[model samples]
Target: MVRIKFFLFSILFLCSSEILAQTENIKGKIIASGDLVGIHIINKTAGKFTITNDFGEFEIPAKLNDTILVSGVEYVPKEIIVDDISMQAKQLVINLEVNLNVLDEVVVGKILTGDLMTDIENSEAKREMNFYDLGIPGYTGPRKTQSERRLYEAQSGGGLVPLNPLINWITGRTKRLKEQIEREEIGIAINEAKAKYAKVIFEDEPFSETLQNEYFYFCGDDPSFKTLSDVGNELVMLQFLKEKLEAFKIHLEKK
Candidate 1:
């Protein structure tokens, strides 16, 4: 019985050693044509996963001959097999390809009819009307224009009391001031969105200063971005931004 117990223990030790020998911690970098940040590096057999950092570098626990699956937004998934050389070096570099879907070409052109009089009448009717038709305030009726209102305000008090210039403050509608405030608010909101999501969505490798600026503008104009930014959920925002970045990348490529 004692001999049997000793044999079982020896077998268990050998199995454990084999398992440990097969598993290794591999450090690697993800290489791609564009940004590599946030790419997923997954060890299929080991059931381990990691994400690339700003530098596209990652470390994951894997084993020899294990399959590593790499994926990212708008990038085609890649499968890499761990080899003896990679295991010995404790390092690997995986490359990913961008998957761009081709679209059908569309041609748009004007169809001109032979009737000159009818065309002239139609063109005249399509001409833009005055501000009244556009629903602009004070442009349709007897109401004063914005400039007239500001002139009146200036004549009245100039935003200060005559007796004491610092005592009484007059505040009224100033179109220029209102426009400036609106611009400033928009700028603040855009910066906040950028601070929250830009780094993660647009990795450090391919996103340069100009590209970053363009992304900011693109997000500012996107309705979904506005909604996500207001909700303030980091995870959802990250996912949404990733989708938007993919679309933005496609747009850039087309340009």
Candidate 2:
């Protein structure tokens, strides 16, 4: 009887320990422009998911075979599956590529505009310097108007058919007229990202805070970002796209 009781106690203790053991966690960071921008961790079976802090770090209970979705403003969303590679919960980096053509319009005549610049500036505007503040590479001019000036200056080396001059002769810098094709390409890239993801962050109403906290780091303040504050749900994404395009319009408008 003593032996049987001891055996039963041992079995119960083992069972309890198994039941109380903590689950393993998944950890990782989201990357953009070659730096951590967001954090993503999920344990759907446990009904838990946590976003990292501003520094882009997070840890959450997880297990083998779980799935995690990582996303951010203007980036491609990625789904991660746990395996031997992910089971260790190693620091993971995710890169999101921008979507190029959402509207199916490949027309290259669109021009860059100041309004687009203003809008893009607003998206993550804050009080800190950003990659842009470092100034665009291979382009030089006054700081305030530097980006503005780069918009119109013909390619300095003049090897690739002089994009600015070709655009100048074609579009002639009118508001209604489509401007430079190069500027349009940049505008489309920016607008496409904004149209697809801005609503996911700004107008979703339920998930606005999730977007602001999890994805966008405060870069600096711009009227463009502020313009999105009161935007309605149906139009929020469109507004973001339009604003970005307006910024692109600057390429044709300047000089």
Candidate 3:
């Protein structure tokens, strides 16, 4: 009886540890103009999610290096990592760039009267210059921040991260900051991947939302996963997903 009771206690302790791991809450605010309410804030690593109130402020459970995804319809999606500084501070502040759709500038090739009928008339048809005409491939990928580009190059094994010799022993500060940025990039990339590949990848074996969230967290833990995601190479990511799917299945079996 004593042995069985000790075993149960150990199980409870382990469970408690995991619960605590995801409960280190971080207070934050969205530093963007316009509507901030209903902005979704998700702790992707922990599978925890929340939304901002009317004040553009949110509190979500997160730990150091955990990825936090911030998304809204009106603003460009952003990811933040819970680095040591953010964890230690009272709150984290994120500045999000609002997504803008600017139409191409139009100039009248002919004089036009301020009349509705004339405006409704079809304009001249001119072939716009494009990459096809130039024989150059077009890039339609998401824009990368400076840190993100560095991280991508690092992952590709050709990046040289230069640091001042004086600050060489950075008390793990540099590493922690880098991790925060890395996690942010990874979270955004993973979000895009889930949207694009979720249906196709899980056709054989569908998973519930909770299970899927856990599976994504497992994938983000992989070192090379972020690199492939950054490149946005469809074939490479598909293969990566297949490999991770098998690994995830094996993990579930072990559990």
Best by lDDT: 3
Q: What tens-digit string does per-residue lDDT give for candidate 3 at 210-254? A: 877778778888987888776544445655777898999999999
Runs with alpha carbons beyond 4 Å of true place in candidate 3: 1-171
lDDT of 2: 0.45
Clashes of each: 0, 18, 0
**TM-score, candidate number 1:** 0.35
Q: List the residue pairs that clash in candidate 3.
A: none
**C-alpha TM-score for every candidate:** 0.35, 0.30, 0.37
Worst 10 residues of 2 by lDDT: 111-120
User: Which candidate do you rate higher for lDDT, 1 or 3?
Assistant: 3
The best candidate in terms of TM-score:
3
Off by over 4 Å in 2: 1-22, 34-42, 104-255
